[model samples]
Target: MKIILNGKEKEVADSTTLQLLLQAMQLHPEMVACELNLNIIKRNKYGSTQLGEGDCVEILQMIGGG
Candidate 1:
């Protein structure tokens, strides 16, 4: 399936969940915020949020500098 990830088109496996996608991308779930199709998805719901074709996903990671 094809989806828009961070404004870029990408292909992912069928029935992919947000959690799985993050893991595949090697991202730390605790450090990032995810938005699906313009809607913010709760961290706890990542495992249940299924991704579909044409879905728009935005992943923002937190960084700290002092």
Candidate 2:
């Protein structure tokens, strides 16, 4: 299946959960905020939140510095 990830078109497995996707991309769940289809997803729900085809996803990473 295809999904829009951070404004880019990307292919993912069927019934892929947000947590799995982040793991595949080598991203840490605690360091980034995930939005699916314009809705912000809670950290605890990542494992249960399944992504559908053509769904828009945005992953914003947090950077700390001063």
Candidate 3:
């Protein structure tokens, strides 16, 4: 399946969930914010949120600075 990740085209496995995607990319869910199809996805729902073909996904890394 193909999805638009951060404005770029990406090929992912079928039936890939947000959690799986993050793991595949070695990203920490707690350190990033995710949005799917223009809607923000909650952290608790990462395991349940499924990505579809052509879906727009945005992932932004969260940085803490004082």
Across residues 20-43, which tens digit of lDDT does each residue of candidate 3 receive?
A: 999999999999999999999999
Scored by lDDT, model 1 comes in at 0.96
Q: Where does candidate 2 have its weakest 10-residue lDDT segment?
A: 57-66
Model 2 CA lDDT for position 38: 87
Rate residue 29 of model 2 by lDDT. 90
> Against the true structure, what is each candidate's TM-score?
0.92, 0.92, 0.91
RMSD of each: 1.5, 1.4, 1.7
Q: Using TM-score as the measure, what is the rank order of every candidate, best first?
A: 1, 2, 3
| Candidate 1 local lDDT, 1-66, one digit each (tens) | 999999999999999999999999999899899999999999999999999989999999867878
- Backbone Cα, N, C clashes tallied per candidate: 0, 0, 0
Q: List the residue pairs that clash in candidate 2.
A: none
